[model samples]
Target: MRRAFVQAILALFLVEAHPAFAEGPLHVDITQGVASPLLLAIPDISSGAIPEVANGEDAGVALAKVVRADLGSTGFYRFVSVDGHYAAADEVAFAPFARAGAQALVVGRVRLVGNNVLAYDCALYDVFGAHLETSQRILVAAPQWRRAAHKCADMVFAFTTGDPGHFDTRLLVVGQDGERPGLHTRLLSMDYDGANQTVLSQGQELVAMPRYAPGSRKIVFLSFVMLVPQLVLADLDSGQITALKIPPGVPSAPRFSPDGRSIIFSLARDGVADILVIDLQTGGVRQLTNTAGSNTSPGYSPDGAFVVFESDRSGDPQLYVMASDGSGQKRISFGAGAHASPMWSPRGDLIAFTLVENRRLRIGVMKPDGSKERILSDGERDEDPSWAPSGRALMFQRTAAGKALPGVWMTDLSGKLESRINIDPSASEPAWSGRRP
Candidate 1:
């Protein structure tokens, strides 16, 4: 289940008038795209041996599985199984798949290199008439073979959609133990595929919602280190800490604006919460939402023009949209549930949030305009979804069955889940960082 989750979150996204998006120029425009899922075939790339065996699961075969996993996880591609297709890239007959409902073919090869390096070659073919789209060669260490496979998938995705791939990014969050006398929350970071797990903050005061600055070595999170619930920034490498707040109110849900110049969050005081933005350069504070109900979870659109947030003004908390300068207020979430935690994906195609359905909490994604709602994680209780820089995977906190303990879980929009780890103390609420660049 965990492996499946990781694969799904590793890929996911399209959509509409996002004020945050600049009208200037698009990084990658996928306005028109093929609805049919891409069809791909990966054969056996046999090596001499594995770390322990001569060959590691047949080079081509293994690489195919990884590519399949990555593409299928996106819910945008339908990879043909090796059981029904020819096993060699050279023998690939595009006629059958293009006729059998496949749009594109992903092919690749891998070779072993002593104990330190592995060489890889990958290609994308327009299976409709068997035309090679593009191809590339990459070199990596033995341990980076899987990563190389992901890169291959990234290349295919970028080539087909004309958008940057997010398979190579990472995610960070707060993890908690299920059983503990007192509150136990810590900061946790891991690769997008659940590799290189590390603890950023031990069970020090509670830490909630950690986000990365654009291409920086620092991470900003809402931490109650002094029990004040202020926005704190921690340098991962140097352990340097910088905090921002006006005293009192818990300045929760800190998120970096698209340009990484400011952070927007909710400042709760006198039992009333409102949206506010902090200027990183001047430490200036400006309020965004001036509604009656408490507004929290303010997220900047990919283009940094609009801010989508949650407000209870209508009696139930629902998704609301407003200009970055706090104008043109409109409600989007009309679903039959109170919606909270609106997160804008870096890709600008979708916004991930937690939806409470049938009295059960689940992680779901929807078009930026609040259409085509799909739940990704529908379980006992799942809330606070944070999207990776790629807008592919979503990291959230889930309580164990019949237990209040919350651990971090990630899933792609298609419902694939990665591994679930039980933290030493109860934990909940997570916000992922944006891409380094």
Candidate 2:
């Protein structure tokens, strides 16, 4: 995945902290129930030495806009416009922002540091407290300037929320080009905010379920080559695609282990389907499920010690958990209707799944022990729940009632902070990537 996109060259120019308060008073307690978004102010960053431009825009303005957009998109911060005031890096007056109902403020400046290199000097301030909380200067190549803004937003989010930010991550999704029967699907890569979209496949073959390895740009997805569905591995860095050697049977639902050294998927031959795992290093295959019915969509626990999957051995498709080596298999879902596409959250606290009841499909999450299950989406059809790197949010495909195409939507753990991601054309099967290097 190192070459998933034009690799952004990121370097730290400077990092300085204000000793006034090690931990700022302005914090969003995410552990508690859903609270209103924290009011934040992000005025235009002051411009410094003009840099060689690629997008032909003011570097300072673009940087601040990106930062504001990143933080606001998380549904954690509500950006308040401070139109008349530009929060320059050197000077910041918090009184006006406080009167504007802003709890926190971000001030920054952008300048050219080297040949084709831009530096984003950002500082996070506590508006009411009248003190600087944290500040950083990040440098990136001109073409990848947006990364600097993402990093700055990440820093602010981390310091304020006490959780790592997912702003610096990527998303892999399947893009559909036409109607069914004659439809074409391609693998696409984009920023987490749905920018920098790049087609990874030729659209010649159908692609689905593109999953990123735990910590790499390498991905394993289900693709059809000449109408034969098989699991293929693609390395973004080298543009090499290798078909996994499977023993007969058609494969589906390919997912990487938490360690990224193996892939767990399901194979169906004849009338039975079971789950299997393949060791990427040795090309060794291991069967994890040998049930009489269909068992698919196997995903690994964050620790790689266990897996959660969907099985219909009990007459209705339900979620099941088992040891990594296929021991202690037990059903976890006994809810009304069917459950499919079980995904273990990165934090290992919950498992997200697709609930099909009375011809309605919705997204829901539950604890690993099959408790505290709750629906998170009310869309007509919501499936494919992919966790953010921080495990605080999920991205899924939502096709409203009477709507023909599905759009990507995101929701926080509480389901109260749901928003649709704006993507032109239709897309599905969103897979969030780990933070970019």
Candidate 3:
């Protein structure tokens, strides 16, 4: 079984390196020169008898706010508010929007379907070309009305940018509070915009490096049990926790495989750490790296054929890649500073990482082969980059001068726009989940 597995992995390496086997839509290269933000007009969705939900709020106006916020946060659009502008979709005047320099216009309306259901009709238009781009009618339970707005914004984002939208995603983060001596951290989940925050774990146990399982509601993290680090699997829905049967070692940086059947992490045995993988179903273990120096922060390529990790085998911590089964290990980063926390983009085009130079940390991205490295952020401390599901942006932890608290902030892949996620009780270790079904 081991021999055949190695052979199959070798075959995959050959195929994956070639151009023909590559799949997925081509992503826009945002690293190029800064472009002007697209002018977009978002009129409030007409509230035609749209009854309030349990929250006693105007569902139509709330939905429009969500849509506007989602698009505005992307940093690729300049919003034209609809305060005194058109209210209903039919009242829209394309000529006025075009004259106001709006290239695209989004108009929608919300109405009550029944006592417990709501319907939203959204439409996108090309103002300059005077034509309708797309339209859809979405229905949802009154309590779930936020999702309908997200769906509408996603449609507009996809129609304009030619990429999948990330508005309908959730983020897993470690929520920390209290003073330094008594700091407490807990696992928390919330919408990408910091809404609907849910605490997934109590603060009794120390946890770090929370990662979401691909296409699953489970998360893999490192939890301290009896002062020993153990890899734990957490189900989001049921709040169940199961410890993986890894060898007795200090586990950290656990990330799920693309198939969600296995996890790759670093385990420190004795005084050295190495990368390893464990199959969840069979409790089978496979060692990926056996180097003398510490090898940690293993991240899988989107296709699951290769794994990138940070290792100090070269005397300085740098990025390295090996086959999924721990073959053909080679160093890929040779920059001036040490690099760590390497995260492969979901679109499979670039790798984001943290670079430390002269005692300062910055977030950057480079090609898979470690070329064309470009630092995208300038912060006193910026680390732990987690890619948005669409690979268009990144969320990382930022700590400013005189502010010991670390807060979560996001920036476009180009670093042209940056915004802080407004969540009380400063947070860190943000892991953006894949688009939820």
Give the local distance difference test score of model 3. 0.79
Cα lDDT of model 1 by residue, 324-345, tens digit: 9999989999988888888888
Q: Pick the candidate with the highest lDDT.
A: 2
Full ranking by TM-score: 2, 3, 1
Q: Give residue 90's lDDT in candidate 3 (0 to 100).
A: 51
**Clash count of each predicted structure:** 29, 1, 0
Put down candidate 3 lDDT per residue, 77-140, tens digits, no spaces.
8886434634554567787777777877888777766756676777777787776667777776
Q: Compared to the true structure, candidate 1 yields what TM-score?
A: 0.76
When summed lDDT is taken over every stretch of 10 residues in candidate 1, the lowest stretch is 8-17
Write the number of the candidate with greater TM-score, choosing between 1 and 2.
Answer: 2
Alpha-carbon lDDT, every model: 0.67, 0.83, 0.79
Please rank every candidate by lDDT, starting with the best.
2, 3, 1
- Candidate 2 is scored at a TM of 0.92
How much is the lDDT of residue 78 in candidate 2? 86
